[model samples]
Target: MGLHVFGHDPSGDTALSERALIEAVDVLIFCAPIRQTPAVISHYVAQAAGIEREQLWLDITSIKAVPVAVMLTSQAEVVGLHPMSAAPKAATLRGRSMVVCEARLDKWRPWLEDFLAATEADCVRADAEQHDRIMALVQGMVHATHMAQGAVLRELAPAVGDLDGIRPFSSVGYELDVAVTRRILASNPAIYQDIQFENPHVAPMLERLAAHLDTLRDLVRQGDDEARDRMRETLLEQSRAYVGEQAIAEGSYAFERLGYLLADLHEPRYISVFLPVDRPGSLRALLSVFEQRGINLDSIHSSRSADGDLLFRIGVSRDGDTLALRSAMSAIEAEGIGRVVDAPG
Candidate 1:
């Protein structure tokens, strides 16, 4: 924690050249995006040649095989690290598995393991090829499956302008799927593309998936009860093997949370108001309007624009207060207090 951190950004004002940065640091960590990882590592690795044997080079790329192979060419000790979770929160990282692939030597392993343990992450030692193989299923196949599902939904159903339209008939599993699908779709598409294209094993995995889907389709078309029952049992057994008992056990609690979320969605929604920073006591005045109506605040987030206008996103929930919220929002809009936007369901 006390270590002095120096960053080199090529486009920034305080940019240090790659050679300078390489020479200054004992440990060089490449945190580049998947597509740029090979080139970035190679560029620095070339510069770092014959510098020092004590220097340790590492990469945190999602796909390990290629990057670890490239890193192995470097004179310095190379370790391939992959944090399993995206944008790791405390709960996600703590006791979570982090794959560490040994490419070259044991010198940096202890330090890396110590650092991972300090963050409460479990270090999983794996070969680069093994890591990539597992990732083909973990990342590649999973993403492809969701992408296919989303595509099917778009082709079959009406355009989903509002997510709320589907909520009424949705199960807890559907809600979870939507949440995960949205999260994946919101991320950089290039990263997912790299995962799909870069992993050599993904093509075969996708072929197998397609074959399995075809089998399922044939089973459905045949309408043979015995065959269908066997297929169902096989699917469940395979799922249990993949996710294990813990996920099955936690599903009840997940459903309970889904119930609470559904109930909240049915309640009166929030109005996100963006007010000018120059207007003093505007927030207090708006709060008073809710207070007068006996409505309670649910949540609030504040940010400032480039022009210094205050963006206040407030959440208000009521059991049967939609009309009241609408009237209050109309009044606030009329007063030129702020522009009010409906919060998404």
Candidate 2:
């Protein structure tokens, strides 16, 4: 990956203007913010009009419709990309997803796919309109829901202290709601606003959401169990139709898994060991085995045994080297310090 990458900041260095930079590169990629993407792309595209048609132009904007449309006007081959992740982390891109909208691809398709494969990122090809449509629901509706929750919570809780105190008594679901709300609120407002406003499908989706909320309120107020049951059944049936019965079943299982994963008490488990707490420094000695082997323990809990001896439960996450964990566990057992109680499937 001996790639020479250059950054062109408008205010920082006026020597290499955007137009000059675009003319110099084989591929011009616009990684500007969502709101500024279309404008930035347009300005560069105008300069690129007289350039060779073989030049490839791309944008990695969250909202694809506008930038894709602008890029289409240029003489260069246009490819709209949206990496379904934040900025690059380290040199590896494994487990990351990149969306590609081939507005006008020729040879650029294979080149782009090969480049993504080298980074080990999953590339998904979609039409520009389809991508924007899905994003409207995926991003726009989701953000709006969180924003609304934040608004209501601000009115109800009113203070940071209240939120901190409420956390101890709240369920994982409530905690997740607050987390999502806060995550959205913490981001740049203009980005979210552009996502919600630029997508034409979002307004209608919001309207439908409003209507659904109103209907649910009415149903709750009526206190009619029969009507509520009927509504629930209808909604479930519609959901099954939309996503298929198998998907519904899988979604339920995923929800349960998510609940367990999100729980404060649940540690990422590769191995769980039960150690005797009666001996002085037994816990420290047990942990030292793992430490010596370079295996990290995520959490350790202690409780009194029925026989009056103390029991220590040590947990290690899957991220710890598996071979090292096994070796450490064997050493602990051989030393008469602990027994491996459970190992992750």
Off by over 4 Å in 1: 10-14, 89-92, 159-162, 237-345
lDDT (tens digit, per residue) of candidate 2 on 1-345? 566776687658777877678767788888877878888877886766677488888888888888999888888888888887755433545678888898887887788777778878788889889998899888888899999988877788756557777776787678678878887887788888988888888899999988888877777788798868866866666767989888888988987776765652455565556665456787778879988998866666665444444555666765778888778878989998887766666
lDDT of 2 at 216: 74
TM-score of 2: 0.74
Per residue, candidate 1 scores C-alpha lDDT tens digits across 306-341 of 454566666676563877777777777787777775
Best by TM-score: 2
Candidate 1 has its poorest 10 consecutive residues by lDDT at 87-96
Residue 22 Cα positional deviation in candidate 1, in Å, after optimal superposition: 0.7
Pairs that collide in candidate 1 are: none
Off by over 4 Å in 2: 88-90, 158-161, 264-288, 291-345
